[model samples]
Target chain A: MSEILKMAWRNIWRNRRRTLITASSVLFAVFFAIVMRSMQLGTYSNMTANVVGAYTGYAQVQAQGYWDDKTLDNSLDWTPQAEQAVLAHPRVVGLVPRFDSFALAASDSSSKGVGVVGVLPATEDSMSRLSDKLLEGRLPAPTAAEVLVAERLAVFLKIGLGDTLALIGMGYQGISAVGEYPVVGIVRLPSPQLNASLVYTSLENAQELFAAEGRLTSVVLTLDDPDFAEPTCAELAASLPEGLVALPWQELMPELVQQIESDQASGFLILGILYVIVGFGIFGTLLMMLAERRREMGVMMAVGMGRRALATMVGAEMVLLGTLGTLAGMAAAFPMVLYLHHNPILLEGEMAQAMLNLGVEPIVPFALEPGFFVWQGLLVAALVAVASLHPLLSILKLNVINALRA
Target chain B: MNVIEIENLSKEYQTPAAKVRAVDGVSLRFERGEFAAIVGPSGSGKTTLLNLLGGLDQATAGSIRIAGTDLASLRPGQLIDFRKDNIGFVFQSYNLIPVLTALENVEFVMQLQGRPKAERRARAVELLEAVGLGERLDSRPGQLSGGQQQRVAVARALASKPQFVLADEPTANLDSRSALTLLEIMERLNREEGATFIFSTHDPRVVAKARRVIWLEDGKVVSDKTQEPTI
Candidate 1:
């Protein structure tokens, strides 16, 4: 066995140029595959951070029909038991309980429809970092009769800080939800749509105005690890009161998930095409190896070396080359991935604008995880192993007499 | 003292026109410790007989018994093992494994036989030394002279301690000096170690060194005679 391995190893280096060329294909495969996949995943990561960071958090608990119908009747009471139930999980980092409803915002001479969100002052401030986004004035006090309007919504209503804004809409059921409060703050949001339509105020003031006191439309949870969001959401949903469904950001914003999934599918397709090309490259090299060593193979077999042994030696050579090449590729791609991870490539021009318009951060980053690299390496190695079937077929039917003659 | 016995051995090859009988109903026997040569023309069955004796190609009709073990009864895989343990082959091209050092090439068959490392190494060194390649043990075949490479092949053939060695035009690719040196080493092994040698050749030098010469013509041994070596 050692003899065979020594022979197989030395045999690969006999034609250094050919071996290097063959291995270069594998190297290129691993490099491009890992980098491409990293880019795709990293872009999704950035987009997830961008979108989720803006408002959705990682998971949300809302009334059963509230997602389909954003009316106040479907809202849940902000009971202490409900808040404690969600915060019980060790993974929970922050929470924002909110009551959101849409109403007409009328100033003295201007009127526009806007999304009104009532939030617990401190928790919303920490989860959404709402105060840091304030363009003017402080966050509205939780119990104060003041509202935080989005810049665009304030612009449309022709109202500024200290100006009164009226909100009129149907509350819980059949009750007229109406109020007029002074705009204490103007906040600039990341999403243009939200900036144009959102109105944030204290939970007390919102419940008072809506005639639905102590009720919350949603409780957004920020987790320590976002990857655990779905499972946590499941556990939370199972334990929560009826008429409440815990939804991860994926379910809450399925369009984003669909977009990332489509990108991932295409990314894998591109990788599949790369593997085929590399497979052919490997096949070509092995064909040349068999062609060049036809007589040697014949002589070995003619001397009573079994078909199995010869084929194993040939296969071992491919594996050695592939292992070396992919490992080298992993080594080579590591720094590039690490660099891209730290200094992400920023999107420019229309691409940046488009990404921004879609509420995603405009950058292409690389995910530099060891698992991704190891998985890609194993995949290439497996492809090389499978490609060795070519040699097995050729050797099984090898005519020692004919080969010797050749 | 017969190490190999054959009865009506035959081999046929299919052609586009008709079937060609490569070895046709030839009967012969090789004695232990005998240095014999099968001499023939280009189209004669000398190589085919050697292939049959070595269990390389299946016989079309008849049986070959090597040391009382019937070649016909052994399966293909079993034949390979039997050949590995009993028959050593030296090809015309001095077919040393180019990737391995001469010593490793010699050790390859012994390794296949699952010999211990110390025994394989000692036997390989002893064989190479006996073949006048003691100083070039570590050299690769590519780095050796044609004569030296053939000597390594000889050592590799005998590494498994086969009962007999089969050579198919073993001296065909060597110059007169290298060929003579190789023949001398093989003759010495036959004389001193009592190793049986049977090779096919058209070369007169090889025919002259053999203690017995079998003249094969058109797949039949027309003349089989024993003669004293001229040298």
Candidate 2:
């Protein structure tokens, strides 16, 4: 085996140009797969951070039947005891109670349906980065009845800071209710859907407008360890009162998980195509090499080398080439992926807004997971190994006398 | 003791046009330490007879026994092992692997026999030096002249110190001077080292130097002659 390996190594280097061309193809394929996968994963991470962490926190606690029905009757009573129980968990970093309702806002001839979230001013300030996201005016006062609307919604309404807007919706008892509140601030969210239709107000004003005192839609919880969210939520669910349930952020925004999974699956398909192209490139070069070394193979066989030994030598050459190429590709991809992970490429123009509307961040970053790189490297090695079987099988059928003649 | 025994050996190759009988109803024997030659024209089955005797090709209907073992009865893997262990081959084309240096090429057979590196290297160097290729040990076959390359092939065949060596027109590609030199070296080895040498060739010089000659024509042995007893 050692002799065969040594001979195989020397044979590969005999034609330096051919070896290099084949190796480079494999390297480029591996590099492309790694970088593309990293970027796709990074984009997904960024989207999850922007949409989940910035808005919904990592997990939420709601009334047992709230998510399915989402009616005013299913709202939880925000009791001090329940709040203290949730907040005292070791993993819980912050918690905020929210009151949510659907309403219509009309300004002049334009009207739009909006999701209105009523939050405590001090709690919202501490739990979310919404205050920093404000583009105009100031955060509404804790005791005031003023509201904050998204910048895009404000534009469509032709409304500015300090402008009075009429909000009309069904109140807690299912009665038709109306309120006049001033738009105290305008904010921008990364998601176009949220930016176009979301409005925020104080908890007191929400209770007054909706006639729903002490009723809250959900309680959002942030965790110091994002990955612990699901398990912690499960634990909370087990310990919570019979009428309450805990839901992770992924369950709240299932589309995000589905999109990421589908994107990765499609990316893998693309990577497979890339490997095919690289395989063909390497196979072509190897075939040419085998053709050129016909006499050499014949000589070895004529000199008492068994057919299996010759095939083994050929296979060993391919494995060596694959290993080196994969290593080179990894070396190149590491820094490239790392650089992109930190500094993502931001999309602009209509496409940017279009992506934002779909709840994806405009910037596409690169991410690295140890498993992803290992799988990619193994995939490349396996492709090369498969490609090498051609020469191995051919050598078995090779006629020693004919090869000698050649 | 007879090293190679052939009994009613016949070899036939199937071609698209017809079945070509390369060796028909041939029987011969080679004793240990004997230098013999099988001389014939092209397509006269001399090489075919050598192939059968060396266990490289099977006889269509015959038996071949080398050193008391029936070559025809061995399995495929056993045949390969038999060839590697007991038989050595020297082709007209020298057949040295181009990528291997002369020393490495000679060491290849020993490596196959599972010989240690140190011993294989020592034997390879000794054989190469005996063949006057000591200085050219590191040079590849492509770098050597036809004669030097053939010398390396001879060294490689003898590297494993097999029981018998088969040479099929070993001098066919060389000039007269190199041919004589190669034959002389092989003849001397046969005499001094007790190694059996068999040649299948039409080269008159090679035939003249053989102690025994089997003459074949049209796939049949026409004459079996032992040279006039030398004084």
CAPRI-wise, candidate 1 is medium
**Clashing residue pairs for model 2:** A38-A367
Which digits, one per residue and each the tens of the lDDT, describe model 2 over residues A145-238? 8999998999999999888878999989797769889999999877777889988999878877888988899988878888788899888876
Q: Indicate the worst ten consecutive residues by lDDT in candidate 2 chain A.
A: A296-305
The 10 consecutive residues of candidate 2 chain B with the worst lDDT sum are: B222-231
Residue A27, candidate 1: how far off, in angstroms?
Answer: 1.2
Chain A alone, TM-score per model:
0.94, 0.82
Every candidate's DockQ is 0.71, 0.56
Question: Could you tell me which residue pairs clash in candidate 1?
Answer: none
Q: Report backbone clashes per prediction.
A: 0, 1
Tens-place lDDT per residue, model 1, A89-158, is 7888778888888889899988888888998878888877788789999898978888999988888888
Report i-RMS for every model. 1.1, 1.8
